[model samples]
Target: AQSVTQLDSQVPVFEEAPVELRCNYSSSVSVYLFWYVQYPNQGLQLLLKYLSGSTLVKGINGFEAEFNKSQTSFHLRKPSVHISDTAEYFCAVSDQYGGATNKLIFGTGTLLAVQP
Candidate 1:
C-alpha cells in the first residue's frame, strides 16, 4: 500500500518567482510517484513522474521534481511562475507492480496561487 501527503495546502508566489510544492509518501512496497496539475474546473494533467531512473523529472510549463527515495519524497519545483500557473497541484503514489488493479493514492492537493 502507498499514500501521499502534501506538506502545504497552498503556496503563494509572485510572478517570475520560484516555487516549490512539497510531497511525501509511505509505502510497504515499491511505488511510482507522480505529479499532476489541474486548472480551474479542468481535468488533471500529468506534470511529471518517477517510475524508473532519473530522480530529476521535468514536465510541461518548466516544472520539475526530484524523487528522493531515502526520505520518501518527490517535491515539485518551478524556477519561474506566472499567473497562469495558479492552479491545484497533486502528488500521487501507486504500486509499482500492482497493475490491472493499481489505484493511485493522491494527496490533499496544493493550490499554487501565483500573484502578479
Candidate 2:
C-alpha cells in the first residue's frame, strides 16, 4: 500500500509571510501528486497537481511545488502568504491509474496559521 507523510502538523507565520509545507510518499509504482487546501468548515480545493511532466508545478493562489523522484517527495511553497491563506493544507498521491474517484491519498494534515 502507498502512504503519504506530512512533516509538520502546524505552521504559524505573520500575514504576507512566506511558507513551505513538506510532503513525502512511499509507493511502488508511478503516482500522481496533489496539494489540496481546506478552509474552515469547508471541503478541500485542489491547490495543484503533478501528473506526468516537469517536476516544478504551479497552482492557484500563487502556490507551487516540486516533485522529487529520487527523494520521493513533493513539497509545497509560496513566496508570500496572506491571512486568507490560513487553512489546512494536505499533500496527496494517487496511483498512475488514478481516475476521478481514485484521485488522491491525503496526508494527515497541516494547519497554516497566518497571523495578522
Candidate 3:
C-alpha cells in the first residue's frame, strides 16, 4: 500500500510571505504525485502534478513543486502568498500501474493561513 505524509498540519504566514508545504510518500510500485487545493466550501482543485518527465512541475495560482525520487518527496512552494491563498492543501498519490481502481491516497492536509 502507498501512503502520503504531510509534515505540517498548518502553515501560517502573513500576506505576501513565501511558504512551503512538505509532503512525502512511501510506495513499492511506481506512483504519481499531485497537489490539490481546497477553498472553503469548495471541492479540491489540482494544483500541480508529477506524472513523468521533468523533475519540476508548475501548477495554477503561482504554485510549484519538485519531485525528488531519492527522498520520495514533493514539496509545494509559493514565492509569495495572498490572503485568498489561504486554504487546505492536500498531497495525493496514485499507483501508476495499479489499474483504474487505484484510488488516490491523500495526505492529512495542510491548512495554509495567510493573514492580512
**Per-residue alpha-carbon lDDT of candidate 1 for residues 1-116, written as tens digits (9 for 90 to 100):** 67899979989999999999999999998889999999999999999889989899999999999999999999999998999999999999998888698689999999999999
Where is model 3 poorest over a 10-residue stretch in terms of lDDT? 94-103
* TM-score of each model, paired residue for residue: 0.96, 0.94, 0.97
Which candidate leads in lDDT? 3
Candidate ranking (TM-score, best to worst) = 3, 1, 2
Model 3 Cα shift for residue 92 (angstroms): 0.3
Residue pairs that clash (backbone atoms under 3 angstroms), model 2: none
| Least accurate 10 contiguous residues by lDDT in model 1 | 95-104
Candidate 2: C-alpha RMSD to true structure equals 1.4
- lDDT of each model, Cα atoms only? 0.94, 0.94, 0.96
Give candidate 2 misplaced runs (Cα > 4 Å).
98-103
lDDT of 2 by residue, 1-116 (tens): 67999989999998888889999999999999999999999999999999988999999999999999999999999999998999999999999866568857889999999999
